[model samples]
Target: KREFITDDDSSDVTGAHVSKIESTIMVKTEASSVVLTQQQTSHLNHSQQSITTQQQQQQNVHIKQQPQQHNNIVQQAHPQQ
Candidate 1:
């Protein structure tokens, strides 16, 4: 009966070790997924910033052209060129 008790104790210890290994693996997988989400969010933010910059550049070009158009109109009216 003593030997049977010893065997049961060893089995319980082995079962606990297996569960610990499983939990560690689960934690590692969760951490990697979190990292992936962070990377995706940053990438999306970069794309949005680039889109806004492009829009600002376009607005600047339009503003620059308006003055040129006014100069052309003035020259046509005065025949100074």
Candidate 2:
């Protein structure tokens, strides 16, 4: 099993503003599990149009899987809170 979390924050003076966001990701398999986490922050001044700031952080876990002897395989992406 694996677990992940992500947070996003954004602000704009004249446009849409996203105050905060949170997300989590997880992956599990018969052989291994993986997890990922990410965070991002951004600020924009629409009046100036030239001033902008952004920050991002990410964390990931990697699991090595053995070569599959069978040809049957599947992949999927699912959102989980």
Residues 1-81, candidate 2, lDDT per residue (tens digit)?
A: 122222222224222322222111211221112112111211122222223211111111211231223212211111221
List candidate 1 stretches off by more than 4 Å.
40-81
Tell me the whole-model lDDT of each prediction, alpha carbons only.
0.53, 0.19
For the record, the alpha-carbon RMSD of candidate 1 to the native fold, in angstroms, is 21.9
The TM-score, computed over Cα atoms with residue i paired to residue i, of candidate 1 is 0.45
lDDT of 1 by residue, 1-81 (tens): 999999999999999999999986775454444334333443453445445544433333443455644644533643542
Q: List the residue pairs that clash in candidate 2.
A: none
What TM-score number comes out for model 2? 0.12
Count: clashes, candidate 2: 0
lDDT of 1 at 73: 55
Best by lDDT: 1
Per-model tally of clashing residue pairs: 0, 0
In model 2, which regions exceed 4 Å deviation? 1-11, 14-16, 19-59, 64-81
Worst 10 residues of 2 by lDDT: 53-62
Q: Which candidate's TM-score is highest?
A: 1
